[model samples]
Target: MQDIAVGGSTVSRTDILGQVEAVGVGSFWATDEEGRLVYLSAKALDALGGGGESLIGRPLVEIFSEVQQANGEEAQRTLGFQLRSHSRFDNMIVRVDVAGDDETGQRQTRWWRVSGKPYKDGNDRFCGYRGSSIDITAEYGRQLEAAQHSQFDPLTGLANRRRMGSRLSAMLTACKGAGRSCALVMLDLDRFKQVNDTLGHPAGDELLKQVADRLKTVIKDRGEIGRLGGDEFQIILPDIDDRGDLTGLAGRIIQMISQPYSINGKRAIVGTSVGVAIAPYDGVESDELNAAADLALYAAKGSGRGLCRFYTADLRESAELDSRIEENLRDALVKGEMRMNYQPLVSPHDHTVHAFEALMRWEPEDGRPVSPAKFIPIAEQTDLIVQLGGWALRQACEDAVQWPTQLRVAVNVSAKQFMNADFPKVVAAALAGSGLEPNRLDLEITESVFVGDVEAVDKTFAALKRLGVRLVMDDFGTGYSSLGYLNRAPFDKIKIDQSFVHGCTEGGTTNPAIISAIVALAKALGMETVAEGVEAMDELALVTERGADLIQGYIYSRPLTHDAIMERSGTENFVFPPSGPPRYRAGRMNFFRKIGVIHEDHYYKAMLRNLSRTGAWIEGLAGVPEGTDLILDLGGGQLAVSKVVRAAEAAQGLKFETALIGDGNDGLMTRHRVSPYALATAGMPLAALPAGSYPLAEQMSASRSPRKFFEVEV
Candidate 1:
């Protein structure tokens, strides 16, 4: 433009440009044909945070890069690429990200918008470029920050639900095209509501933050985790199809998140149930995979809280059963379908009954017997546990009052019922109504009851103790409760968890040590210790030697009805000897079902007589030698490599080469399963390989090889 005339002088165009450089509004620059900086304004030198002489010969493109767009797509042309092409460009946003590039040290990244064109020299050859740049750091930074806020959860700084969904969709699409697999894990906190209800919403927020942190640590760089509102979360684990790895990841997640949290100076404990689904096997799309993972999580919760389960086709049936179970459970009390069976807690020293634990049994109207493992979690999720627990306490007390005066009865108290303000009153009412002494009632509680306000929990415990009822911490030494809690609560007894009791007698196990420590801890505190689930003489002997004060399990007797107790009480036949297996067997389920046994290329039909994590019994196969390596196809894509340990006639005992993991329903399953990719590679159609059927992956099904053993019908 034209120069401006002042009062006594005229301002030249060069002088106006110098004023522009002095104000830091914009900067002028020129590059040689080699794209090296030949001239730069003083403002540009300040922006580079370097001396003018030092930056003169440096490549201009080295000092700047194109700003990345909001979307994750790569830029078609970078500034360096464009500059090398000798092409004109306009209004391109660029960023300087070099360390120590800021003059004031207040900014690490400087944004610029510039326009430039190729210029020719005296010889008519391309020699340089001249450009001007305006600082856009303020506006561009705000845009980037806003974009970040939209994609992440403010509290945990994890991806939000929308971003996680988009990521899963994209990953699944990419994996499907590449013939890879992705795993989706769904989970939510258990009993988190009790924390919020007792401690307040702020503490709940703190707990969620801690949980998110633990998830980050456990999953670390392997996947993306997102909070889908409330206590629910979803994880996208890319390129993982092996159930073995997924099992480990899900386990670590549950273990990490289930640890105790100190929120607002109050201790809180919550558990998580994880459900895993793999793409192309469980589903090929995002929605399908999510639904599958959700169903698996439902099954995990149905089995019980604090477990992990993989998606299976049968979970759909289980979902329906859960619905039916919940419906029937609502009317179970009114229909008189619920009953109590007392399992005697006997003194191991005298083999005499010290007390009976009142266990609730419900026989539904449909005549199907649903285990507590499947239904109690459902009840806890709703308000049914409180009602059922109230009824159970009254019924158990009423039944106990008829027994001999010296014997007391223990009744299980749910965390839901225990946390209620009126629970102590409920216990008093049950005792007064049944005419049973207050001391005759033992209130069974678990560590989960200590999840909320510390003062409130202490007050409840004090109130129960004031009523003269004994407090027995059920499932003690199960990693849920610490010794510090024992000092806080007044417990008359501690029942060692069945988990420690089951394998105590086996060598190389820490259960014996844990049992000893528990018994010692209880004795030191003047509290009685009962070894629960002592189903074998060895287990009984081990516990008795470890100073356990009582034993309560099948080793003495199964849970008996009131009539059976009355019949036996007349004769005073309380002194019973331990009657169980002579040794501790690795607790196998008597799973009698048809399965397939593959040895080499020959597939033999066999009957699975029993199944355990370590081994299984198979029949319907003859002439199979011991130490023979075989693969047992236990359906559901489970192929267990095993060796015949015991061979007799048509019966054989097979030891698993690799032990199976929990199916999350108290059953054993192979950790790694045959994937669809492997099936497709073997030229087999994508079909379900289930129990009771043998489809030899199509390629091996047409083998003309001779059979190794005769397959007889069992």
Candidate 2:
């Protein structure tokens, strides 16, 4: 009921074939009630290919040649039956031959589905037929595939168990009715597990497939064959008519399975046992026949594994021990007895301890300690690793925050733990609850974590970054992580796996080359590199000489307690040494009660106008670079100092290194940035002023570019 404008006027029809053609559906007309072609949609013309428009007014029979006309009449009669019965065939199969080219220069027949229904005119009079003919060649291909698989096996493409069963059932039924004979043979390969164990499962599978092919050649049109399962096969011989036929088929199968197979350059001479059961003689039922065949199989196995035997009643004792070990592992995780240990990572220089890496350890009271290589894989398969990883993170962070400021702790993360949806939030909450600084925490993840759901990894990393925790790519150069991911990932450091480190100390020069390459790559990417498993001084020296930033192994003390960390950091003098700086001592004589230092005749108030170690800025005359090294010469004496550290928008003052004791009762302090003085010049509150107004032009320019970009009115 939609309106459309024509060239001059609008026309309406109860059934608009022309409108349907305009919308690209194939539409056509037929003359009178005889179904003669009149007009057609462009889609119909295109679908018919070249010169199809020439037969617009031709009779429907003219569209087909002589042979097709006969087929067309039969199709019409079938369609008439369906219509009269009011039965709809949703996807009834039909085929048509269209002209096509093959490899050679000749035409070939192509198939498509043809549909038709009676077309009616305005007065409710039947005019002709109209329906869409769709291409269903792909459907026909799938149908063929279904039929093929229904009969043939997926692995060897020989007859499968279902097909073989059907064939055997039919043959047995026929033989029982006709007073003939038939036999069923079963096969089981011997030492097949040994082949799989020694040569790999793929080779064993190839052997089984070859066995099927060989059996087919030997039996040749005399029986049906199938693969029942791994190393198990079945054969059905029908129209046998005697016991000799059953014996012959069994011998042929035994001979086929006894042959040698060459797989992956390895020669394997494997053997199989065959069992036979005759229908109408052994048992009448299919299950009984199969039972007898199984008994025969067991007898064949008992007779030395590579020969055939007839079924007997006493061979039902050995049915396999249900060796599924997966159930015992399921309940092992819930009892809560997993444990972990920490390994100390020592600084190669001065043996100052840096961090402790948390390593998982598990030992069940009833059983021996489970190897990390064993239980870790199982834990990862379940959710045990996720819970274990969270426990590890929390414990590490708690212990880390209690350690001296110089040492930062690291925890290894498994691939499963890294992919956990709550990993980032868990890490953040752990850090916050532990009262630990984010920079003191490091998460070490293996390269395998990057292989899965990269988008999820990316989001996880983004969440971790919000917590300010450092990420280390654990065991670099051992996994499939491309150099590209290393470049893009938010990794703070890369730890060379212990295996590679172990090789680096070996006298051979190859390890050095590989380690050097890794170091160079890390350097190029602005990442710190650490070498693990440096157990000797020579190894330490080699790694340190090659510019390895960190070394962790047994060369130093193992993971220590908080008291041990304090002891390692040295005595109270080393932990809390005194700091010296300019002291403004009046002695009832010094003016203005503030110390001053002169830099290029601009006197900087040493105490009030100086930088605080707590990162506050005060007004001072001298302006220095963000990281400039300078000496402050107070009226008392000179003290070595560095300039303020630069920050985003706001600049921070330097960390004091050497504030020396000057003349009598006076201490020399460092100079400060002139930013506060610039702030006083503007009416704006001192803290509110932009950093750019300072005489420290470089710091001002870089730190406050956004503030300088636009004009501001006084």
Candidate 3:
């Protein structure tokens, strides 16, 4: 058994055999052209537990027979046929069951797959098969469980959404071939959110599982039932004969779901609203039918729960309206029609301009202004909100560049926009494009955005914060109100919705109380509150008294254009004279000596605002506090006052008279302006009047026709 050198190894045949036997896996031999095992390596023997020496010179059939009954001569014949039919087999697998030792408490034997490949001798002749037996029972079990889970619900072990999808696909094909109608029913458990919110999530989960079980029982042998996800489930009814069948099935489902569910042995009642759409009647296509079913589901929910709704053309029309709005909104952005309107946000206390709230407007060429309520939902539905919101942000930033650097601009962002994958990029683009400081921009998002995927939103919000931008949760306490969001997401400000603000306003004093509550809540959260829809003076005062940080609405101004805002803010310093009927005066009033005696009726109540003599201002006016020179008529004559004594309401002493700086005798004589009484000396004496300490008009007193004062001055 001495061997010649092969591949730089000079050893005896016995040494080569010993080396092959030492391999960790196993080696084996077979002699017949059919490749039956004639020998087994030591490792192979150990692998089979003390059978190696005994198995030498044995046919493979005899060896495998003890391992598995399925591995007899018939199996060998099948393997021979396969080897002859095909080329060299790789990873050829087979499974055999073997019993475990008694100590392991084995009842049923487990199965494994054995992989083998034909081995050959140096003469290129077939020798025997050599391979390893892998215990793949666990892996095979996992694969089976995974397959089952793919088709079945994890909670109730009923079929799941994936299985429903496959089944529906097949059903549609079958229906198409037979020209039959099938019904797809989708159900959503109503009041599910309240249950989840008031009770615990674990309780909700148990209820859902119980609901699923009830649905399974109700739909048994009728059709397939599946848990679509969350509190949603689906049913597929094939071969629907009539509308009544579907209604009956839906009725049964509602009845079953309406019953009390025992969650942790606690009785809880829940109901479902079912939506049904039939193939060939509602829609010919599967997806269309499913969409119709969803529309019907929405209608069912809209009509109130514990009922069902069938898809109708009207629902499609409403759905189409949504579609058209969404499509048009997307086009509006492309067409350069989507614009931002700047509604001045005023300080409620002083009515001083604080900032502008950038409101979105879609002004079509042919129609009136499209309300945000009309188009905003469309943007949300079509996800055009992300684009429109970005455009608004850019426009606001650009407009802010023209404003006082201290003035911030706020742009609202919908949940759809805020949740966009590229929201950060969109904001960065806007800021870069407008060259506006990020700190001057506020992004308002509703509370809905913070409800789900909070981690993603948190990270995005943090990124926005790093850019020196402020984030506000708008319409707080409206939908899905979660205090947990404040604890999680960083909110710099909060907007009390117009509904709440308007309600408070109508409630008057009660309104202030509500505003106070909201303000207090905001302050506790370290947030500022901006009262929306502050459309009346009283409302403004009320919100101011309640400590609202900001106020915005029509009471101040409607949304203005960029040019209008620039004009209002820039040219606002130049003062204008009053426009009213001029009085006939008999005086060339020296401009410096002329104190414009403005009567109470001559000035607007807005102009009769709070002030002191030393350039103090009306507290509630929307513009600059200081007054400039203006012409005014005191009913006796018109004079140019260098400044106004725009006195406070309390300062209008007696008849709300203002002081005149000079004597009227020479002042009136320069022009054709006359007064009823003449001035005198001693103590400011009255001429041609009755002898009383106060001046009085005499009966049948001498009168003179006065010339017009403007012509006389000219």
Candidate 4:
């Protein structure tokens, strides 16, 4: 009953038309002038998935809708617009209303490619629209899969570097316009290379996947996390510029990633270092922000692994300085610029010197002193650490040989140096060349030595044990705390890290409990435990009570030069009295920094002489009476509310209303900085804060309060 045209031939074939409808590839659909479906073939009804009877008079637009492009760009025209214009539309992709599911119980989207044209009656009057929609589910799914592959890492299911860069760019653009802030976090795994080199590549892949999953649990919906290849990762946090919050998040991330992972029935532990940068504060652009974060990460890892550092302005200078030092480090030993400073470790039971830890000191020919923290990592990166490590071992043996025969010398070993195949030969050469007793030579090793093949690491330990030098574990409980390390490797002593000793006497800290647990574990293992970094009497008393076998830190002495050590080598001089502060006080940094002080409406310049978490000593303003309230501007839009607690002729000690936060570069800062939004409201252009202070607008008002204090012209 219908005329069909095919292959330049026309014939009346009702069976051929029925076969077309039965094939289910697609079917005819027709709607009234008002756009309600009036006619639908069997296949068209099946495509809607159900309720064929109810769909007879429903609007076709209700069944399918337009979607944004996969890359999140807006479409040029919507399906509704095409329908309303009564224009011809062909091969337009649309989403179906029915919720379909994939095999993994995840919801899968359904798509269709539709073609339509407006039809007219015999009188050439507009009647309705006739459309055909083919099943494009499989083809559209492949397109979506390709997009996902481009944006996500195949190994970890996290966003790739390209995707993260795009995301950061888009977020910065949006936040810059809205006067909001975003923070970027850069982190990478420590000791991850060992996992890869020890285990197979497949195990490394599994570990990375596990790390990504843990990051997701911590991040939740707070931000986007991406893998920047290898063991490196990045996260984007929105609407936050508070340093205090960033510190907490960074700490959480480090702690989370430092936990142990199980890969192929083998227990692996790794540490993480985090660097944080805030947009419109650290930088307003993505590349600038990334550079800032990278510098912070460098500082974090260099200081110690498993730490978090916030990007500060001074890190760039420090990085440049490190670069120069790295270049000079190649010849520092040959130039006689490096030496060992000894700090004694005394036995608590006898109160006598038992051993001395050799600390490396670097002084360049130009009289510039380089901190070990800054140069050590650089040496490691340039493979100069191997040479330095060998030199230090030999120098310690030579230095200790000149002291009492019974005294022991401890030399710190880098993971790289300890893992070298000829490490035992180096130890033997140092001992044989210096004529020092093997038992008197202690080799201090960190937990990070468990990086490569377990069997190979065991062989190295065995080889070192055969050298007759005692093995002492350094910085215990700081990172990689698997009991398997202690169980397998024979350790003679354990050195408790200084971090636990810092605030062990403080009421709220859990450091005392951790120290006690460490001592107990060591005691049970028949290992001698030395509490490190005891700088005050209270800390010494606490560690003494915890049953530590030995104590080493400033309570006895700072690092002594080789001549100083020899000056006290006699038996009578072995006893060192505990001399330090009577009680523990939180560390305070003393420096001269010009800052702005505002009392009432008057702004005066002051010098911050010393800073701590709880208070600061300021000089410049006279007659600042005790109990007087004021605002201290520490530059870069930072304001601290304080009260004058003690007053002198031209100096005052101020107690902060809120405790200050660490700038992550061993400096103090306000918890929150003044925002760009506030600056824009005060008539400045909307942008990141520039250097120096931003005075309060209310204090800059026309009606100023009378000045009650004198500004000392120091």
Candidate 5:
């Protein structure tokens, strides 16, 4: 061994090499032209848990199985590629499997950064390469943590907005290139702000974590879910284009998320509204699709939250309609455009009116009646509901005071109004100011009031109870129906939701069973039960037979105006005899509008008197025979194929070939209509379909026969 002088001391070559190896800053390694390891430092071999002699003939690339770029994406240049090309590489990060011993004795993964330079013989032929390697496992882990922190929500561990945006963009691009479809669902949590305000943000954070877990369970392997900041979430489903399947999934999500959650030992309930958009059909790009889904979500929330909506071309109009309604509703209270209509609830035992439900109706200044279904939800979304609800309470109380009889007046209260701290005081003021007996006033509330803190809900109930007023559970068995609510809240009556009454009398419907059980449960609880929406004699008989204590529907009378109720109240006793259809059938909507009917080569104009899912009655068709096939054009390119089932004097009942589906609004519509694409193919301009008439006239060349029936003015 030779001695080397350094600074102020002399050291042997072996001692200097030993000092360099002990520091363990890095290790030096060499490979043959075939990329086989020829030399490895003893220190490196020790770190790898092997002797340098044993790894002498192993392939270098085989030791490092995978390589990744600095940004965490898979590297374009693999270790094998670089080694086979005999090219020099610098600072390449690679993952290697190392032998290790633990209780389970499994192989452990380790990361390394290796830099190498290729060497060649004097003949300019590649011979071997040398490289220096450093262990980077800890630093790689820290980088991974930082990357995840940037990409995921800290509270829920779900992907954040940036990551979701990137993922959606990439997925949409790939789906467009492959000519496939992707479904994106955007959801916003309902009543989540109440939770945050009531239980504090920590509880809200816990609720969010639980929600994320439920989402993962529900969407397992089928899609990816991301929390897009706050209470909004986005889900991406690839290759799923079926609306039916998407609807089912969205429903599951809504139902699952709406179920009761326990936060910090207190029960909290919230709901979610989902809007879905399909790629290429709804939009081709990420931003466009996201906006479409957001608009659909807005529509869902506007159509009363806790629901799901699939995006359609008509949603833009619906969104605009909602904006208009919301704007109008803000001024409706001051303008006196809102009124109360009373619907009598009659006892099934004696058919005498037991009470009247005060339903709110909005007669806008434009002379059009806006359905409560449309504007009530809008009011609830803001402070307008508290004002509207207070007005209704006072009006109902005053109206009941004028009645000769002590008939109870049931005033509906929204969840938002009920959650207000001064709600009970408002009720007291209504009763005191009207000089009405509190016992004659019933406050109808839904299950949503139970969503807040138990102490708060209980306090409200106690305060209401102190006022000597009757509390009724309205819309029972509709949403979040729990016996626990029945056990906790002090309710005097249970009003069956109209949905249960719709098909209860029909064959093969489990609604009868459900109604029977509800009636039984209400009876056992000593609460009065009223079955709502009894439109026919059969439905009435079924509910009466099922032991419902009272009934309210068109079978008795539609919502009556104040004058009508006052006129009836003048009598000693009032009883509304059940007057409606003899048999229970699908609901019929009356419309006196002219529609085009096609028979053979003649287009006859007829009046649509009434319509149902399966059939319709049209007048002004003089002599249409039985089994005559006809096409009824209901405008907007909706053509229904029908056959005359019954003929009469200038009128006929036609059975449709296919049943109509719901129009999202409370109307029936044909499933498929003439697409703008079809209109374009028929020589019309290529553009979106406009409202009103369908552009089918230009394509039809058949001659029209003379009108057989005189056009009767409606």
Candidate 6:
């Protein structure tokens, strides 16, 4: 052995190597041409709990595995691949498994940074590998922890936005190549700001943690969840394209997140709106998909929070429309374009108009009338609602004072408006300025007002009551219809939501039971009940039999303009006799519009006289016998299959094969229409349905034949 000078004494190379190994600074290892371990240093064997002899003939890859990163994710490079490639490796980190369990009953693990060089024989044949390793367990752990800190949220312990972006990009790329699909669901917590404002940031952080926990429980291993900053989260679901399943998952997530959370011994309630976009269908790229989902989220929030919306081309248009509305609404009040229409609430017992609910109507300077349902929510989201509410209240008060009769004017108060500190002042000012008796003004509030700060809500109620205005709980059963709200709030009346009344009179429906229960509950609480949206005689009779104290709907009269109200308010007791369909008929509309009827390879133009959920009456088509099957093209891709129930010269009453569903605006619509997909199949481009006839004449070859029924000029 060669000797070297050390500390003024000659030391051999072997002695130096021995000293290095004994001090645990490094260890030597060698593998045969087969990559099987031929030699392992005693020190390394000691670190691995004395398995050197047993591991001598084992493959080097079997003794050491790739190190796992601190995030509990496996490192990409593999020891086996490097060994098999017979390539030189420098400072490759790996994990070694020890022989026995540690005190905690977990298998002992050790990490090492290994460097190896492939060796060759004189004949240039592959021989083996000579390597050295150093214990790097502690250093590796630190690096891994640092990496985890960068990848995960410290507060929620969920993957942070950075990790999520990287994962999403990678997943989208892989799925694209494999012809698979992925879904990205974006969620925004509703009313989360209120929680932070009320309970402090610490509580908010705790709530986020609980939210993360709930997400994990709900998502399980089906998807990966990441916190995309405050109150926003993203989920990556692999291999999921079914909209039905995605919708179910989104709903579950919303419900789970909406459940009340207990933070710091106080209860906090919040809701989540979700937007979902499936890969390739919504977009092929990650960023594109994210943008689609964001648009969907915007639509979900716009339509009303606590709902989920899937990405569609129409959502962009709807979003644009909402933006236009938001911009135009700011100038509406100043421009005097806003108005109120009064809908009479009649006494069922005597058929007299007891009160009129003030409904806001907005007609822009250059546009047609906009529904209150569309713009009121936008106003509520901003400070515009305070101005709007004040205006409505004052106008209603002034109008009511001018009436000859003591008719109460009920004005709807939104949750945001009600929560305002100066709301009571606004009401008092309206009442004092108009000189209207407080008892003649009824404030209609929904259950949403009871969402936050219960004590403040109670104080508002007390203040309003002190002013002598009657309070009515509106849309009682549509929301969180807790008896708790009725118990806490001193409501003089409860308005059963129209949803429960829509099909109450239909046979085999459960709505009647629910309505009866609500009536009983209201009676027991000494609060009168009003059934809303009653549009037929049977509906009226059912509500009357259920002991509803009042009724308000088209069955009596539609909302009237201020001029109409004045004309009808000729006497102090204006009583309008009930004049609707004899029995409950699926709500009908006097459409009187031109439509096309397809019969036996011929299309005849006809006039739609009236429309109902279950049927329609058309004129201008003569010689169409009863029980004749026909397709009515209602335009814009809506086609209904009907059988003529009654036929007369130039007139036919047809019954639809399928009943229409509500159109979300209290109008009837077909459950399924001519889809853009079908249009595409018929050689049309895949795009939103354009305004015109669907199943175009050329596409429907069956309609090419000559007319069978004589067409009458409309």
The C-alpha TM-scores of every prediction are 0.87, 0.38, 0.43, 0.86, 0.79, 0.74
Cα lDDT tens digits for candidate 3, 607-638: 22222222222222222122433333332322
- Clash count of each predicted structure: 1, 2, 14, 0, 0, 0
lDDT (Cα) of model 4: 0.83
Residues 1-714 of candidate 6: C-alpha lDDT, one tens digit per residue: 589887889988867777899987899899899888898877888777744466788888888787766665557876678778888888887888755635655567788899999999899888999999999889888887898888998889899988998888989899768767888999988777777876788888898899999999999999899998998999999988655567677778877876667787776677778888777667878789999999878767766666677777667787788888989999998999999899999999899888999999998889899987789767877788888998999999988898865688999997778988999999999999999999999999987676544567788999999999999999887654357678878899999999788878789989999999999999999998999999888889999998998999988888988888887667454786777776765567898678878775556778998988889999998888998999887764567899999999999999999876543233565644454335535553322234445445345444334656898876
Residue 182, candidate 2: how far off, in angstroms? Answer: 34
What tens-digit string does per-residue lDDT give for candidate 2 at 53-121? 665776654453212221111233354354444333333344433343334534333234445556566
- Regions of model 4 farther than 4 Å from truth: 1-41, 48-68, 72-92, 97-109, 113-134, 198-200, 264-267, 482-484, 570-572, 679-703
Against the unseen true structure, what C-alpha lDDT does each candidate score? 0.83, 0.59, 0.61, 0.83, 0.82, 0.81
- Count of clashing pairs, candidate 2: 2
* Model 3 ranges off by over 4 Å: 1-293, 296-315, 366-369, 505-514, 572-714
lDDT of 5 by residue, 1-714 (tens): 589888999989767655777896787788898889898776777777743355578888777666544443446756677777877788888786765656666677778888888888899989889888888989998887787788878889888888788878988999767767788999988888889999999998899999999999899998878999889999999988766567678878887887889887898888888898888667879999999999889878877776777777788897788788888888888999989899999987788898899999999888689988888877887888898999999988888888865588999998889999999999999989999998999999988787756678899999999999999998888666457799989899999999899977778889999999998999898999999999989899999999999899999989988789888766755788889988888888999998877765566778999999898999887767788898787865567899999988788899999887664456776655544345445443322233435446456544545644454444
Better of 2 and 5 by TM-score: 5
Worst 10 residues of 6 by lDDT: 683-692
Q: Pick the candidate with the highest TM-score.
A: 1
> Candidate 6 at residue 549, lDDT?
89
Better of 1 and 6 by lDDT: 1
What C-alpha lDDT, on a 0 to 100 scale, does residue 300 get in candidate 1? Answer: 83
Ranking by TM-score: 1, 4, 5, 6, 3, 2
Encode model 4's per-residue lDDT on 547-633: one tens digit a residue: 899999999888889998887875348888888997889889997878888766566789999989989899999988899998887
**lDDT of each residue in 285-385, candidate 1, tens digit only:** 88899999999998887665677899988889988988888988999989989989999999888899989999888887778777877778889878899
